[model samples]
Target: MQQTVVEHMDRVAEDVVALTLRATAGDLAPWDPGAHIDLSLPNWLDRQYSLCGDPAERDAYRVAVRYDPLSRGGSEYVHRFLRPGRALGVSLPRNHFPLVPAPRYLFLAGGIGITPLLPMMRAAAAAGAPATLVYVGPSPATMPFADDLLRSYGDRVRIVETGRHGRPDLHALAATLPADALVYCCGPATMLAAAEAAFPAERLHAERFQPVARTFGPDTAFEAVCARSGDTVTVPADESLLDALALSGRPLPAGCREGICGSCEITVLDGTPEHRDDIGAPEGRMFPCVSRAVSPRLVLDL
Candidate 1:
């Protein structure tokens, strides 16, 4: 954890505020493109925001947050109460949406999802790699960093206003991409679903702000055996495995219990797991926050 002070705040768009935070004591942690830091807010709320500024600048970390009318206090607090000089607790940068090496890259960002791809676009241009960005938003007025992006990348950036022109045909765009080109997308669930269907699983990479529909059936009561402690806990059908583990005297570190954050991931030593997280961790590992056991008994490495 690091103590950061909000050095600057600006309303970049209609409901989006861009924040610049600087460390109070030491240099801020270095981060690469596509990295995000968890901001700890009042009322025990923690939300993740992508680092949108230049990665070479070690003195400050920049993030743009959009105010969701139905936010769960995270965005509302930042918009309403956060100001310059305010101290904030922030976690070290974590990157699950990393930019992989590719001959060419196609970035598709929807709404505020453009935050992470902003830094990526800069890195790609600096490397002299062939890259293109298709930024889609509800309207021109609500889009953050639109002017900066247009001014910086001119012809490389394509703007799609969904309000003016119904949703852009992502399938048509995907069809035009080169065979070896990597497609990175960050946006709403509907956009992600379309991308997933248009591109191959190996070629398409995405980051989701919310969990998608569960493909599993109804939950069932199961037994979890802690491999290290040799303790068994019965997980109720209506309860999450994380909650059941806590009730059994074994509490795990968790953030964003809705399965968006990969904080409470535990190894599955034995038995199958009904994976429910959007994090896409492979087999043998499961997010206990929303995932449950599929077999009668699960042997966890915890």
Candidate 2:
């Protein structure tokens, strides 16, 4: 988990700042698209950032962190304080959101969500696969890696500077690509929800950088049985199944515990799982971090 910083460059836009860190990959684990690494800072605060560079480059890993206005010191530290060439400890790549192999790949990114999709787009292009990227942001000047993406991909990539125009038409998105293409999107909850509503489930893959806010309709309790440990735990109405598991001393490798990162995902052996995440193919598996059991008793593959 120990790594030394190799290169650090800050890409500053009007509204966002991205810090790109090249870390020593001696103990680095190879990662595919939608994979992320966890960083342990000096203050015991750990955060996850997606890999935005070539996955095959084993000598180093690249991650971009954005400065958010609503951030809770994590982004603040990265933007204002963190320096280049500093040795740090980082976890091996943990991937929950994986890129599906397809004939064509359609990528839709908004603002900071573009971090994860950048590497995927480059990889898809390098493979000579047909791919189109539609990036929407406040403006051309505010969009991160805008000129670089445009210069590289050219006409295949579209940029929607919403600050001047308006929201990119979702209808246009549905009409732009072929039906057989696989669509991947990452952005605000509203954008992802709209995409889910517009596209068929079979053709879409999404990752939520933010947590999915769930409104508990009423009080509900459920039981979870861990298949590996053969341990039984009760999920209280106030606590999520993941929190309960962690509280019981089960160390689950997780990122974005809001059910966005696929890190805490486990197979559902029994009982109906209330799917809360928008990652990959939702074939009824459970993400314990945000998902809960709709049935009375649930059996997990641990």
Alpha-carbon TM-score of each model against the true structure: 0.91, 0.82
Error of 2 at 130 (Å): 2.5
Cα lDDT over the full model 1: 0.89
C-alpha lDDT score of every prediction, in listed order:
0.89, 0.78
Give the Å shift of residue 69 in candidate 1.
1.1
Q: Provide the RMSD of all predictions against the true structure, rounded to 1 decimal.
A: 2.0, 3.2
Worst 10 residues of 2 by lDDT: 18-27
* lDDT string, candidate 1, 239-262, tens digits: 999999999889986678878777
What tens-digit string does per-residue lDDT give for candidate 2 at 5-36? 73666675665655445556553667898888
Please provide the root mean square deviation of candidate 1 (C-alpha atoms, Å): 2.0
Give the best candidate by TM-score: 1
